[model samples]
Target chain A: MLEVFGRRPYLVLLVMALLLAPVPFLQLNDYIVHVLTLFLIFAVFATGWNITLGLLGLKTLGHHAFFAIGAYASALVSHYFGVSPWITMWLGALIAAVAGIIIGFPILRIRSMPHVAIVTLAFAEIVRLVFANLKDITRGELGFWGIPPFNPIGIGDTAIRFGLGNAAGSFALAAVLFVGVHLILLLLLRGRCGLTFLAIRDAEAAAESLGVRLAAWKLFAFGISAAVVGLSGAVYAHYLMILTPTSVAGPEMLISLLAMIIVGGVGRFFGPIYGALLLTATSELLRDFGDYRMLLYGALIIVFVFIAPAGIAGLKPRLGRKPAEATKPVEAV
Target chain B: MSSTQFIELVLNGLITGSIYALVGSGIALVYGTTRVLNFAHGELMMLAGYGVLLFSVTLGWPVLLAALATILLVMLLGAIIQRVTIAPLMKREDWAFNVVAVTIGLSIFLQSAAQLIWGEQFQGVPYFFSGVAVIGDVRMPWQRIAILLVALAVMGLCALVLFRTRLGRIIRATAQDAEAALAVGIPSGLVHTAVFSISAALAGTGAILLSPLVTVSPWMGASYLLKGFAVVILGGLGSFGGAVAAGFLLGLIESFSVSFVSSEWSNVVAFVFLIAVIWVRPEGLFAGRGA
Candidate 1:
């Protein structure tokens, strides 16, 4: 399985994407389709976070900041400025990438994992507090509602609508963006960019010795990851047509991302995707459990770490592959 | 603006700073000794809050006795957590990120479990000390003053132990070089667990002191946890002394800033200060100091 994935990763992703593409149109409950869409959104988010965290060995616990930045930027711009969600979404990603780079400048200088984690977490808190306090603009936890959805697209005689009334179009849109993001990640990681990240993660000093600009490469990864997270956030905002600072920028968002990557198998290319799918389903199933939902998720994270530190991806037997690589913990500097 | 107000603010800042010191130093101590940033350190404080509530409020134990019992219980919990969750991970060659992740998981689990057991309603504890002390134009509650004095005493005691005790020597040696410590027949793993317990005791103390002022709730630890982390970074990661000083510095910063800015923006100001500090001194302000 590892060999096949290693050799033809795109083929596997394409097959998976193809298999899931029909779900929205399968006439299933709209709620189920909505949940699947959420899974894709989170998968995008987890994958984005993995670039900085898993690949580059940056122990960031604040990727949700980017998500919130994207969501709020897109929502605010589209809702207040009359801009289309389509345009604002990309703009939000750009904004988030810039924020990422700016934050990265200070953060990348710190070598300690705990320091990085604290700094990033503090930054996210700052962001959350700012959004929460900006009552005039964000409405201050009453939640920003009535945000416009993605404008309907017309093709020939048919019109593809968005909003809750039409889940298929939204799911289709999410799927397209999901595949596109993955393809971009695949291309980037399969090339020199991935090698540089690998070098940085595996041996920072060695990579730095070899003339790899550590800060620049890290900023690059951080920026791209932030952009992808922002994009997902933008889509989520438009899909849900509501926004709350806590819902997007809170530590809960960060924990969810962490759970996904950890459960999926950190450092593996498709780990977050599998983790997101499993957790999303689990989350929906545990919805009836109400307050116990997060408790269970938390317990699941610990149990998985204890029982399967390699995550779901690591559960499979990878013949001839380096077991050490699968189990290797993120190096703390 | 007025001298009296300024004095009151300073007193308040110091009182708040004392708690910050407790929380921050706990985090710094754990990180310094174990190199595992315990993300769930706040949960220890949270558990202590619930513990005090259980023993003092529900069971009708005396406040001091309940507080003492809570701290001990939390210390025991810290040891258990370190042994069960962290020790195994640390045995692995690359356990840094895994330990951090596991603590995060543990934090969430503890928080949610607390909510499940206690419900979401905020439960207030009656202040053990009553009455106010009038000094010049400033009036301070005896309870608040007690928080300051007790916190100072607790931290001072911790300092004494860390600097003067045999266990302290063993822990510091392990922190400096685990292999060297092990070669000297020091049980580094046991030291790690001990350090965790000590850290939890500090956080538990903070929780007991804070419960009367702030209502006990499941998510009570979250904000203070962030502030505590900020204090750690500001002080320098793993430097207990630096954490103490930084904690006070942060508390004062927040207290003073709240006067000029809105209360909500004080957090932003405090965190911005942290980021600026990180930018200038990534190794922390006291990076070279030994554990």
Candidate 2:
């Protein structure tokens, strides 16, 4: 597998990936870049959710709570204590990880897929409810604004010379994140835990018989996945400089995450990336279609799932058996 | 704020919860039989709401007629959905997937369709009973009282049918064990379609009965659907009795919370309880009732 994308090919793809990162730099205004930045934010969330739903064979409809937790954690730290958002982002991730781990232990022990999704969705909704109702603490629906922006090391010096503003700096920060996440994901895919995750997806009974700790790995994957999503949320809270309970744990965000994973192929390495890009971009591109946008997207997803569970990109393998093609990478847990 | 208001709150909560029970039972029945969570089930209720709004508000028909039209039309709509859309997808393990995906798609489709047909403005369905009634010193809306009574009656009929008749036996058999029901010569697939129809009909009843209290809007189903899903989870997914109890419980909680807490906090309270319950006991408050 590594030979096909040998050092030279991988280097080229990596350069291409780096080129993709500079999209906001070429953009004219902050609005476009901000939306593009949102795409990046959701990409991280979708990838995190993919770790559980796709890799672990656990269909979760909740994780919105984790996202909210991270945002709240960072927001609380920055808004109240005047801590740096970058530092608080890690704290937010930790909080969400702990919550995810706690939830995973009991819920993942149950033996049903749809039940898990239902229960998770309920949990997320409850988190949203609490956040909305806890006006004294979280500020409820009015939302929390005026969060201090992040400043990376050595970036201020570079920004002064380049004359880049907050928006541009935000884009740069997100770019680094995109690259970091991709690298980490690539490493995770090659690990033994990744293989165990895939085995669990294939057949839990068989995997259990093979000595994989059911609760342990499931909780591990859910925890790490949540931390990743939480980090994304923390960055988002600081970047947007506002945090609303609705945006954090709402229908639209949940649907976006689900749509990305579903359309991209649930268990593929690039599913979240490809899916987020397609859905986010297309949802914008076809804005003129108004409400039909979701309908069309849903239809497309249904057709894809029906004909190609591995997703449209996975269709490359069916034309001819060539070792050159990237095998449909099962997004291992 | 007062002792009178407290009693009023409890009564109001019970009334609102009655509507939830009707919707929840319908959803549970279909799920019990078909193992499909119909996302569009809420849409049917919305459509019924619009139906009554059209009949009572726009057409200026009698309230009874509007209510009847809603139930009939929505039942037909449910049957047609099953016959045309759902029945074709019933043969595979992917039956539930197609059901969920298509219903989600259809929900978006129906919401927009309503938007195009009725416009975005909120349309009120006139109260079945216009004035408030008093039992002792506590005043109540006659419509609220009527809604409670009708809701209970419909639920009672539903329970009777499920537990007392030959058709009920078939539904119970299918829900209990589809493979065994089929082996025993019961047509489980047909029963699934029928149960789905029955479920939609119940949602339609909720729409008609509750329409007077709540305004009809294109996106009304979204919020209500979340509540229905929550009640299902809280009560145990396929348990009819559980759904009824949970519906009341959620409603009562919302009512009392809204009285003591902020009105905005009521939904939050209900949802938080939902999450806590699921977090503590993933099976929900009941056992083996979920997918």
TM-score of model 2 vs. true structure:
0.89
Pairs in steric clash, model 1: none
What candidate 2 keeps of the native contacts, as a fraction, is 0.33
Candidate 2: tens digits of C-alpha lDDT, residues B32-57: 67777877888999988888887788
Off by over 4 Å in 2: A1-16, A21-35, A136-138, A152-157, A160-168, A287-303, A319-333, B1-7, B83-85, B94-98, B279-291
DockQ of 2: 0.37
lDDT of candidate 1 over B206-277, digit per residue (tens): 999999999999998877998898888888788999999988888899899989999989999999999998
Clash count, one per candidate: 0, 1
TM-score of chain A of each: 0.94, 0.87
lDDT of 2 by residue, A1-333 (tens): 222122343354387467766675685577666667777778888888878877776877788889999988888887899887768989999999998997786576576655676667767877787888788888888998777777555744554111124666676677677778767866775568778888888789999998998888889998988999888888888777788888889866776677787777666656677788888888877778776665666566556555565553354455655455446442212
